[model samples]
Target: MRYLKRHRHVGDPLEAALADTALGCGFARPVQHEVLAGMAAQVPEFAGGRKRALAHAVFTMLGADLAHDDFGPDAFDVDALHPWAAVQVTAAKAVLGRAAGKAPLGAGDLALLASTQRQGIVWEGNFFIHLLVLHALADVPGMQATVDEGLGTALMYQRDDGGMPFVTDTDTWSTVTAGLALHATGAPPPVLHRVARHLLRVQHKDGGWSYTDRAQLPDTDCTTVALEFLHQLDPYAYRGPIRRGLDALLAVRGSDGGFPTYGAGTPSEACMTAAAVNALSTQGHLHHGIIQSALHFLVGSQLADGSFPPGWSRSRLHTLFRAHLAGNHSFRTPPPPIRSMHEQTLSLVRAAQRADGGFGQQDGSPSDAISTSYGLIILTGQADPAPAARATRYLLAQLRPHGGTPSPPDMLGPRPFPYDVPVLADAFALLALGHLSRRIRPCRAAVPGRRHSGSRPVETDRAQHHDAGAAHSTENTT
Candidate 1:
């Protein structure tokens, strides 16, 4: 791994990717802000950086999407990104709007970086917001103190290269995901064992996990995926933590029989419910009672076309496929309706495949590694292998000597704007490839000297999934 990283030459993508995963224990020095930095720099005097249309392409794409989303003016659906993206866009435009005197000066008008702290992020979690806050507050009065603090927080995520990631401290989240991908392919290294053991040590008292070790708050999404990793690492060894995690997950169930991204009393979300059912049902008899209701909630929430309600993921297939796999662990025989939804979802996946054999966030959108990975995960083990095989080849073609491609961001952060978690694309590709390998040649993983738990990967609260998750094992992804 050191040889390739230092020598800088073409290498086998999978070997290089897995080597990267193992050495880092699955963490990546995450990056984002092509669009955002462009906007921030465009703020005229933004930290003395000049304006550039760095986000021109994405702006065009998102703008085209707004026409379909109705720009959400008459009504805003929080789940569908109505006002969230609108808020960011408004703040983004205010950078230039301020110059033409077109920007609104009212406090509500600026809506800058929202002082509201979602439980998902620590003050340090989202550095991009602090930078945008500076852009929005560029000329506002009585805000010097806030600006100073915001700049300090923003700089925390800055790299020596002078670019900053949208978020940081995703170490725990990245570790589990990278571990799962490697585990799916084969036994993970002892380094991952060390990392997972630490995860166990930090498991919240209530049996949940936050995205980072630095966070005090634990959400259902991270908790469930963490449990999946623990179980896959070694069910018996981590039984105590897994059980506590299950209890924590159940504690957060909404009245509708679904789970939410965060804790109890939050509204049940489609992807979260699906993930809860997947992780809970995997352990056999123990969680069937819980799974039934959550599965019901998820199925009821499904769109007529077989996709579940959209949340954190940009692609419908991301949650749709994970929900499909999660429901497979149905109590006894699957109910006719539940079985039918799985079939329907599978059909949708088949339908959504592009001519290139890869899948995209939407049927006609350009293909990307992240969404394609989710598609392959669901398509694997189907009666037909053609789709999954083709997708696999397409994915491999996209991988670079450095082990990544320019996959579009599928996850939403702080609501609607896409935030890149670069490792996810690689992790999921590894996961999908593993699934395809297993489907074609059904080889057993030789249990190594070390322990591992988990029957699978997981899906997200949104544009996220593990083959074993398609994954938060539903919806806001890590």
Candidate 2:
């Protein structure tokens, strides 16, 4: 017997043979990647996105035009929609109207609709969303049974505090990000080795890594970070995995030649492409023809104001940071950004700093630890030491024994909603602090147990920051 069918949508150019098949991993991937590889990219726009497409599809199946505000009271001809749309809208609205409340839905009244749920934008199904759909349907007839199955899945990620994360966790991301931070701070070789081992241990058969060990579907961001971490330590040793990951990453570039978060048909994000460029350079692909094309894409993507298209993050600094990373690794005596682009970016970053020496996700927004960290990372290596220095002071004040001050979520999920994974804050802050240690002298308080050995990128006492007190506090707070 096979798993029950979930959906039958494989719109556009074509579909997988299994598009109409029973649910399982088969239906989870609806697109025939090879066939759709030549199709145009679908950017996530507010006016016409996966949500709109899904609505159109549902209407088509219902033999109706999509219901719209344009069809208000007597604006458009309802006669044009006829009995078909009239009947379809009433019936569809009946079920959807029950989906009234917003997410974190405790009542079966609200729904977690998937405009496009192939991912929570980047990764696949997560805990909170499962509960969202489950709770939304629990009061409805016939859906009472799905509550057990859905809650069973959601509760797998339930916290000891009886709470759950939107996504269960970003184990692979947290590991590599935190590991890379700790690595820079001189984390024990054994600890770093274990991280490398875990990544290696859970790598998918297709030669990619996912956001968590439990997941087999991989994305460019996680895979690139994992590759970067492994490459940094021992490129020669991890060469096999690196090659495989590069193959997976390179395999999914859009027709535009930029990388997407996950494989095939997804929009090619500038930040993701930048990351791939950086990671690929570690493999000596900096001058490869593919890299050249990607570099060109990166150059063209930058706006006159010196920004690139935003990535999955809500942080303004995310793309700039990624672009910096990609630019730093290039071989045109360092390629991209050209002189004007670099100057423009530095100007914007400088202008965005708050008087408190912190940076917000956007200019004029409230200062926060994670965004400040991104600022510090961008400013640290610059010719001018001041902005980075001020950012360093800001984070220093905000530093808790746990990591950084609690910050707002900067990651966008399922398109518009935002969520936090907590460790991401810790990891980025630790990383920023490490970069900042370069320009300033550390106080006795900064280094609790260890001393910096006078390095180029001075190591902050992130190890001390995350030690005993932090551990206990996180257990209680998180």
Candidate 3:
């Protein structure tokens, strides 16, 4: 509470929480030191390689440094540069050079330039992309003007309360994710309270939430996250919303007993199902019939390599970790079926580990920060600390000077969309480190009702019956 008074930045409190927890838990290992040393030595190489690659592409395509105007008239030829030349030049010399061009600019050329610049920074059509592009193009002169304009445009999407939506007019998903991340970091009470109120206010009449308040159709993924966040904050206070959300989760169950991301007709997905199980377990719905069926689905869905099929993320590690967490929470006594599933999942994750002590999205892929983080989270509470130790090392190696981690490009959706959000990578790394360190404490201030009890309120028989009925109905229909 005292720390809350001093910090106001959206992510600062969470970062501090993680740092403090890691320090208190003594999560650092000897292996991590060696990894850090090696990474320090490799930093110049990595930075140099990136600089070279970026410079080569930029120079080859644009000719003459956009940073400088040393290139002659031929280099700035609008005809030769046709499409590219149309892009707004930010450097003083480049602007002047373009202005001095004799050929009148065509509308198509201008349009092409505008689109290219937008794509370069805002390709995904999200405000966050604009911020990333601003950081990426910070050194390019004249680009500042474009960045400033883009920033204004991006700001237009911001909600009145200053929270940013992934896109304009949709705040639930982003808010929930940010709140959860902040909660994991031990964010201050007021900040979390604000987030909680927003989520509660946006809860749909059907007892679930979608990606946005505008999208009235409840999805399993967002609803699960919302329920989990509320449960963590104050289960008793939020019992009403929690019950409604649980029912909504049950309503979307596939005939196979697994939960789907969207509506009933949609197929069950590994990630969504895992999320459902975790959320349900959080609220003491672990033994419900629907959960049992979901567990069966998860076991049946495991690939030969021990990985689950990908859903939300391209990284198998993502689904594997989620499923592993689900199993850990869903099973009270570690039944044979769940235990076997856990072993197989752990083996696959361990196998995916690289010699560098990090994990990849899958076997044969290069190790990355996000996947490595997921691996650490999965292995942290297990019997062997070695895998988690190695993963912590791998993560330490990826930390940037500004305290963020950069992961390689990854797939976001069914399409080939590359999700290169560095900030998200940082958040996941912090979460892994927090779990690995075992320093994260429950938020007593945020959820004072359970602060003294330290026990989750039990689910009522009525809730269990409703869940069973929903599960049975889904099975009959499908």
| Number of the predicted model whose lDDT against the real structure is largest | 1
The parts of candidate 2 lying over 4 Å away from their true place are 1-48, 51-125, 132-144, 152-163, 285-287, 332-337, 402-405, 437-478
- Looking at model 3, the pairs that clash are 90-142
Model 2 clash pairs are none
Each prediction's whole-model lDDT (CA): 0.62, 0.59, 0.59
Residue-level lDDT tens digits of model 3 in 148-217: 7777776666666544444333357666766666676677888888899999898998899976675545
TM-score of 2: 0.67
The deviation in Å at residue 245 for candidate 2 is 1.1
Give the Å error, residue 320, model 1.
1.3
Which scores higher on TM-score, 1 or 3? Answer: 1
User: What lDDT does candidate 1 reach at residue 259?
Assistant: 87
The all-Cα superposition gives candidate 2 an RMSD in Å to the true structure of 14.7
Q: Runs in model 3 with CA error above 4 Å?
A: 1-171, 285-287, 439-478
State the displacement of the C-alpha of residue 26, model 1, in Å, after optimal TM-score superposition.
41
